[model samples]
Target: MYKASCSCRMLERKGILCRHIIWIYSSNGVKTIPDEYVVNRWCKDALRSKSFNCNGDPAEEIDIIDAKQISMSKMWSEVHQTVGIPMGRSKEVVDSFSSLIREFKEKLAPLGSQMSKEQEMVALIGCSTTQEVTIFPPKKSKNKGSGKRLLSSKTKAIALAMKPKRMYQNDN
Candidate 1:
């Protein structure tokens, strides 16, 4: 896509085609502008392209800071393989899971950063085994705490529910 865009730009610079022509066509050039090419390529099917012309080396990492731009499924499959998890019945599990985890992290980041060192460690005690912190009842203490008494699990859930994290929403 980058190649196509750049070539179009260069051609327009020399007046072989106008920016209007490129905008309308938005496809590869074989040295001629067929009027029909503009209409068909602009149709919805062209939006399904898996690759983008990022204008960098194919090996270069794509800049992905926003939740929408990032493909959770792709990243998740990679980590799943690295951890030696079997290629499961659905390879897309990790990506779906990662996206969830990423959104959760973006939400929790401010709360975590605001925490004191000790609080952060306590949160870590919960998050260490799980991607997002899910405070469970302590293993050794058999006596259950009442709902009136806030435990880590209840506290974390309440925090998450009360304020949907707004920190990363700007990426849209």
Candidate 2:
């Protein structure tokens, strides 16, 4: 004979009705939760309806690089839509996003090199001549201040003073 009211936060958070709601329904002689209460995203067959493969492509025929690029693009686009678009309105959000992208690019450089090595190996094995292989030399920055800046005179003097004394002298 007790009155119970659910906050419905479980429905909002987990996309499923809480036990309290279920109990209330059961006590009231309701056979099951209503169709409206069940979210499509929580359904087991939600992703199965989509024709996308593991690489997130609807098309069955696609190369590994193309598939990877397509999947990554889809992922980034989704992320941009969900998180970036709203947050991007603010300067702080834009700066944070730029930094995050810079760090991500730095981390992904090695993976890119690994993929290039894999492609080179595939080419060496003579799998397909249709696969175009182009090697470009690393481009040097034209900017004069591309790297570390020279230390100030005071800092250089301090560094020279901190240097360890040589134990042995070599005449040669």
Candidate 3:
């Protein structure tokens, strides 16, 4: 224990402090290191430090796990056969999902076709008007007082250019 503490102190001086020095400081004794003290100190210290200098470099780069490539059938038949997961139920669920996808595609196909037709109709009736349909003036105004209220020629022209409001009485 004496030798270990000396070694830890030496490491601390050499700018190579390990968990052992923290362990020593935390326990503050020559005997056993308490787990809680070590954990608390390390956690608090870790938060302040920019990067962890401990455990230098990783051995090698490992490939990321892919669920798609991992054959569910193989996983069921051999690898995970011992587990309580019902393969039959899983298969049904997969099949059910496949059926749902198939149904969705079928429904979407008709909708797609209908949309294309509707798009064609919309193309036929685009925003641009085909024939120059001259807008005739309304024969008369329902409100007799509307004409009497004199407005500027510019205002009258703007009013004339705009689409006339239909005599639709409000229900309110």
Candidate 4:
């Protein structure tokens, strides 16, 4: 068994081999990554046995039954696989994929959620209140600065324009 290490210590910290170590292995005619370097935590089935709630009890597994949700989940998985291909190719390809994903998010934002912004936030944060909660507007807090009215940009611009301009008087 060939043993090698890199100064980066990527394998030590992240449980993944660094590029230098990969390069060394490739140059040494090592056709495949060693089984020892591959961490169990990164494996797809690693979390299968770790399904537990905060109280150390096994969490209830909810199976997806909704046709739309099932379809969407499958579609997302497909998209993820497709995107993974270009990730190792080039910077331009990755950037193009990023912009495409961003555009999709922007276009789908309104269609995804029917609730108001505040309600959407509450839903996203998983906040369930027993009583109906009324959210009032935030009260204005006094600043530490001495109470002086700050001049607005428009007012400052007007003040600047009203200032007397120095004209050259002909000196005989």
Q: What's model 3's lDDT at 89?
A: 70
lDDT of 3 by residue, 1-172 (tens): 3334455464546544467665656576646444432444445545443333223443343357557546755655774543334445778776776687588779878666555665676655543333565687879758756567778999988988896777988999
Off by over 4 Å in 1: 1-89, 114-172
Which order, best to worst by TM-score? 4, 2, 1, 3
Candidate 4 per-residue lDDT over residues 1-172, each given as its tens digit? 7788889998899888999999999999999888788788877867655467533577677555789778988998998897787766788888998899899989999887578876876665555333655687899987888878999999999999999999999989
Better of 1 and 2 by lDDT: 2
Stretch of 10 with least lDDT, candidate 1: 52-61
How many clashes show up per model? 2, 0, 0, 0
Local distance difference test values of all predictions, in order: 0.58, 0.71, 0.57, 0.81
1-172 in candidate 2: lDDT tens per residue? 3334478678778776789888888988888567778677877866545356433457553326667668989998987785546463788877777788789889888876555765795655534344455677889868767688879999999999999987997899
Give residue 148's error in model 1 in angstroms.
78
Error of 2 at 97 (Å): 55
lDDT of 4: 0.81
Question: What overall lDDT, based on C-alpha atoms, would model 3 receive against the true structure?
Answer: 0.57
For candidate 1, lDDT tens digit of each residue in 1-172?
2233454464545535566556655554445556433444455755443443323223434455767435766787777775554346365876776677699789878885576776676664433233666587867854666548556987898888998667765665
**Backbone clashes counted, model 4:** 0
Kindly report which residue stretches of model 2 are placed more than 4 angstroms away from their true locations once superposed: 1-5, 41-57, 61-172
What clash count does candidate 3 reach?
0
